[model samples]
Target chain A: MSRVVVDVVLKPEISDPQGQAVLGALGRLGHDSVRSVRQGKHFVLEVEGTPDEAELKQIAETLLANPVIEDVELHLPKD
Target chain B: MRIGVITFPGSLDDVDAARAVRLAGGEPVALWHADHDLKDVDAVVLPGGFSYGDYLRAGAIAARSPLMADVVAAAGDGMPVLGICNGFQVLCEAGLLPGALTRNSHLHFRNRDQVLVVERADTAWTQDYRPGQRIVIPVKNGEGRYVAADADLDRLEGEGRVVFRYAGGNPNGSSRDIAGVTSENGRVVGLMPHPEHAIEDLTGPSTDGLGFFTSVLKAVVAA
Candidate 1:
């Protein structure tokens, strides 16, 4: 089995409405010092069967990650 | 025809998406964000929702889901993929399609019935419509502004990949009034409007969105 890790981050300068909303709520709740909050997701997968690195990369580029607004990284642990 | 609807942790439209697929005469398969299997579906629909609670950006978190790995592979092998609303955001973020969705110029969440001009009818999700036809669908989002480098915009326009454009007035201040776009091969499509919500006249503003689903079915049959 091969394990792949995918990380998705928003592009700079793109205001995250959800994050901003959260920040506003936080301030309202008396939590200061949280200047900003940007949210993202991390995905880890364990694929059964032996797939080559090229195939894994293809998966990351095409479906697993959006290249325009987000960047992704794949990690294959050595057996 | 089995179509897969991917459900990210915060996905809100998978059920509606499945209903639309079923109404359009296709089976809807539920795919999880943490699963790698695509369930051998024919097509895939990345429904709009606050995936990962719209963290970092809309669709940014959900783009890295486990199922997306399989989705990317299937899309490359000619499997049709449609990204709607947040789904469209995910598609752009994932780099499956060009451009990025930014905050609405008004910096507010706008939701209303929107009129769209069909610019490209050859794509898998738009074949049922004629070029220049105008259809009304609902669009609701906060970060729905579409942006791209000037050169990229020119290339997208030059290549005829600008599949849908807003008519009458720009709702979200999208550049060039773009509402939807397709990949170079026309296999992948992403639109900012919610077609799944417009499939039924009684429930939605219009049934114009049904054509998108029917169009894909026809494309599959023809292929």
Candidate 2:
């Protein structure tokens, strides 16, 4: 079995209210050194044997992320 | 006129949209998201709700549903399609409309009666109202903020595709205070407010929303 990780995040130009809220909470909790925070979703997929890189990219682009407002990154095992 | 109201698994306002169509003197055909059939309806309404439990993102999964393929094809041919609230999200996700509806800047699920100005009355959905007319309708959503590329936003404004603009106050921090927008062909419209919920004075804050249904009926008949 192989695992692929997908990270979906809002584009930098778009506003992130949830991430801002979390940053505010962190400030209240006295995490002063933090500069900024942007929230994102992480998905770990377990696939049979070897995962196809192209299929994983398609899944990430078509479903895991919205290209209009989000960017996605894929983490795959080294061949 | 027969208007189809599509119901996804978690749709909460399909019945209300149908009721609005009936009130507008049109027959309402119920459509399912899992089917490809459009039921020969003259118009289609993508009603609001957390379809697919809003997984991944609001309206993301539902946008790729089977029925949406037909909806997109029909919309391309100038069939009138109205999407309300989550329906608006679906329309954007399906690429039937430009821009994306994102989380509200306030970070809360807001529900309230909002005022909007009809900026363009030439679309299939807004013909009943005069330009610059003000209407009160219930706005409800958690992720309703509208965002788009700056050039695209400017182009929409330049092309007069912005159908409605929030008046008095912006409910969700939408860019340019846009409450609703229409496709370039003017037959498809998607908005973040629940016009279905405001079709009747007895249950809604005002009867202003009836114009949307009535306008579409007129458009279909005229076409």
Candidate 3:
């Protein structure tokens, strides 16, 4: 069995309002050292058999992320 | 003219959209998300709502529904399609339109009457209005901020594809105050306002939105 992890985040050019809100709260709570906070989605997938990078990339690009506003990164489990 | 109002599982404004069509003298055909049929409608309206509970993303899942396949094709063949609010997000996700609707910069679910200036009246959906007409419509959504690459925005502005712009003030911080835009051929339009809810004087901010429904009939006749 293999587990694939995907992280999806908004593009840098796109405004992250939620992240900004969190940053505001962090400052109020006295976490001044923290510079920024960008929110994103993380998904872990379990497959019966090991999947190739291309297949997982297609899944990440197609369903897990929107190319227009979001970027995606994949993390495959080590053997 | 027959106008199709699609109802995804979580759609909340299908009935209102259909009523707008009926009030505008067009037959409102109910279309389902899972069904592949378009019911031979002359035009289509993707109404406002939190389809799929906005799970993965607003309108993302619904954009990939079986019926959307047909919508993409018909829209390509010059069938007029209007996407409102969440519907606009779906159109962007489905690649029928450019850009994406993200959470409002204020991170609030904004609901209010908004004044918009009609920039283009020659499209399949805006023919009933004169250019630069100011109309009042209800704008409501959490994810209504429109974001696009700088180059795309410039091109759209150059081509006059921007159909509507906020007049008084920007509600959701959309790029250049753009409330709505059109496809290259001017057939498909997507906007982050509730035109369907603004069709009746008693129930809406104004009857200004009736033009969108009425315009499609003329568009069909002209076709």
Candidate 4:
């Protein structure tokens, strides 16, 4: 079995309203050092065999993330 | 021909959607999320609510539910499907519709009677009204903002796929003032308003929402 870690995040062009709200809350809480905050989803997957990088990318593109507004990153399991 | 309404665990409007179907002179069939069987229904309605408690994303969890596979296939065969509110979220997450519903721009759950202009009367759901007809219906949601890529938005607008546009004022800051949209083939539609809630004047602000139900009947007969 192989393990795969995928992270889906909104594209730079799309507005991150939730992250902006959190940034505002941080300033209100007196944490002024924080410059920016971008939020995204992290998912872990276990597959029976060692899937190729192309397969992983296809899965992430087709199902894990919406390419129109989001980008995806795949972390393959170490040997 | 019967309209099937699938009830997810946390669905809040399945009953009302079925009632609206009955009122529109169509038999209503109750379906379940876990069940893959579609029960030979002629059409399907994914009613609104916080399905799967809106975990992962508003409709992300429910979009992958067992029944949705069947729903997607049936929709591919030209079966009409309408999604309202959270149901609209599910359709987007499932890739049956474009765009995503994000948190309201003003950061509050809005609930009120909203006016919408029908942009296209060609969809199976909006054929009862003429193009540019105005109607009032209730829209309630916090994550109802619709967003898409600039190119996709241009395509949607250019191809006349937009079904409804918010009128008077943009309530939730949806891009291009889009309140609803139809699929490429016009067999599927998703909207952020509660048409079923506005079908009866005794309980709702207006009966303008009945056009959606009646429009489907007309389409079904014409088909």
lDDT against the true structure, per candidate, is 0.86, 0.94, 0.94, 0.90
lDDT of 4: 0.90
DockQ ranking from best candidate downward: 2, 3, 4, 1
For B151-218, candidate 1 gives per-residue lDDT tens digits of 78999999999999999889888989999999888989999999899999789999999887888888
Worst 10 residues of 1 chain A by lDDT: A8-17
TM-score of each: 0.76, 0.98, 0.98, 0.92
Task: List, for all models, the DockQ compared with the true complex.
Answer: 0.17, 0.88, 0.85, 0.45
lDDT at residue B42 of model 2 (Cα atoms): 97
Q: lDDT tens digits, residues B118-205, model 2? A: 9999999999999999999999899999999888899999999899999999988999999999999899999999889998879999
Scored against the native two-chain complex, candidate 3 gets a DockQ of 0.85
Candidate 4 lDDT over B1-223, as tens digits, reads: 6889999989999999999998888899999999999998888899999998887678888888999999999999899999999999999998899998887888889999999999999889998889989999999999898999888999999988899999988888899999999999998999999999988879999988888888887777777
Clash pairs of candidate 4?
Answer: none
Candidate 4: regions farther than 4 A off: A1-3, A30-33, A44-59
Which residue pairs does candidate 3 place in steric collision? Answer: none
All candidates: TM-score of chain A: 0.68, 0.95, 0.95, 0.90
How far residue B114's Cα lies from its native spot in candidate 4, in Å, is 0.8
Which is the leading candidate under DockQ? 2
Tell me the lDDT of model 1 at B178.
Answer: 96
Q: Report the C-alpha displacement of residue B74, candidate 2, in angstroms.
A: 1.1
